[model samples]
Target: MTSTPDVIRGIVGVYHADGGLRGELAYLIGKARGTAHCGLCDVTHHALGRRREWRELVAALGVPVELVHLNERSPAVRAASEGRTPCVLAVTDAGHRPLLGPDELAEVDGDVARFATALRGAADRAGLRWAPDER
Candidate 1:
């Protein structure tokens, strides 16, 4: 977890149980449906930074990731994606924006690490912070 206070840019709110991400992140999670398949899926199930790459991402972004299982999501949840699955979204005070789709992440046959790195870059640009557990 980051040594600095959980507040990112002075935005104060509750965090999710997965890590200590801002409460607003939850809304974004709820808006999306369908968890993207990644190398860390089996281990972390529904988290953003379950693996090493993701850890670095969370550390950088300072927020916890909540992955929704698209295959398992009901039609209602699918509405959030508007039929776009396996895409990265950046949530902000204005609204959410699409970063990439599964097609973009799939690098030379499901290179999840490469995809993660790309996501890390995007999150980094968005000022996301990394929040690791007590290690």
Candidate 2:
């Protein structure tokens, strides 16, 4: 049987513009019952954990990542379905596309190393920052 962590690493799903992913993350954490907490750090940790789990699963299972948009589909969707991991959907007035930040692009060039690099690059490009857990 697959462990919880292993199961977490194999899920692939779509994120809608209406904050579906965030909502799903919250739901997942909430389902943990006593394990869930009201503290900010706790919430953030849970969310990040979910995100990491999703990413790992997509990578391990070769699952496609997709983004929802009006009319046309995002290139990232195509790339993801084509077996690209760590793909991003950038919503734009023109349309969405599969995009990688410098780090993500760099990571794609190699193997597993690309995951961290791409994540860092994507965070940098998105003006977001991630810190390791205190534990």
Candidate 3:
């Protein structure tokens, strides 16, 4: 069976919003969902682990990592393409915009290096404080 790290290292795709690339990175923050939790303790631990991992990663990058929970019709998507808001450019601004159709969606399953680089760039632009691990 492939471990989560293995799976994250293999992902390669240019996810786009409104037909533009939004950079590439290992999207491994939410892959553990749906797995049966052994018990209440297990579930709590899993959630805590996820939060810790995310915090550590973001801190390492030294940036303000905003988790944008977009609904089906995401305003960020619209703002990015139309240049209506700066928040929307969070993932699509830099030079890493993906090249694809407006409706096409790519998935980055495991490409860790690319994901890290992209994330770093985003963090730099966003003026986030990097953690020790990110250095």
Candidate 4:
């Protein structure tokens, strides 16, 4: 793949858990019990809510980033990321391409700076370019 300016339309991050109130409670309890885990969640959220640095990073990238739970993924995202929760996908005209996997997300260790670096590096390697800084 080769880099093309503005080719990437958006980014989709898939969480390892399900959605809905019940799902949220389940995950919260499971997480506290050291059972459930979602690396992407670690990167984007905290006890209070979404991380400030994460929001800043998303704004700075100028790319629409949608975070979805396992049950909320679109069909294309589901096909591309089945059984691979906690991954990041680069959405383009061609389709959704895997940018970062679970292990890669885990390596960020909930640091927004590290996650940003990893995401940018992965997008570059995947030949995807951010849309002109819309923000």
How far in Å is the alpha carbon of 85 misplaced in model 2?
13
lDDT of 1 by residue, 2-36 (tens): 24432222111111122225433543565355332
Best TM-score among the predictions, by candidate number: 4
Task: Give the winner by TM-score: 2 or 3.
Answer: 3
CA deviation > 4 Å runs, candidate 4: 1-6
Provide the lowest-lDDT 10-residue window in model 4.
1-10
Give per-residue lDDT, candidate 3, residue 118. 52
Candidate 2 lDDT over residue span 3-115, tens digit each: 22111111122222123566546645664764432221221124335445434634443323343322233454544424433234433222333345233443344243444
lDDT of 4 by residue, 1-135 (tens): 555543888899999999999999999999999999999999999999999998998888777999999999889999999988889999887889999999999999999999999998998898777777656
Where model 1 places Cα greater than 4 Å from the true spot, the runs are 1-49, 71-80, 108-113, 120-135
lDDT of 3: 0.29
User: Candidate 2: minimum summed lDDT over ten consecutive residues — where?
Assistant: 5-14
Each candidate: RMSD = 11.3, 16.7, 15.2, 2.8
- Taken over the whole model, the C-alpha lDDT of each candidate is 0.43, 0.36, 0.29, 0.90
The candidates, ranked best first by lDDT, are: 4, 1, 2, 3
lDDT of 3 by residue, 1-135 (tens): 322221111111212211213211112222245321122112112433433443454455443434321222245344443322112133322221222222211122223333455544544554532323323
Instruction: Report residue 19 deviation for candidate 2 (angstroms).
Output: 27
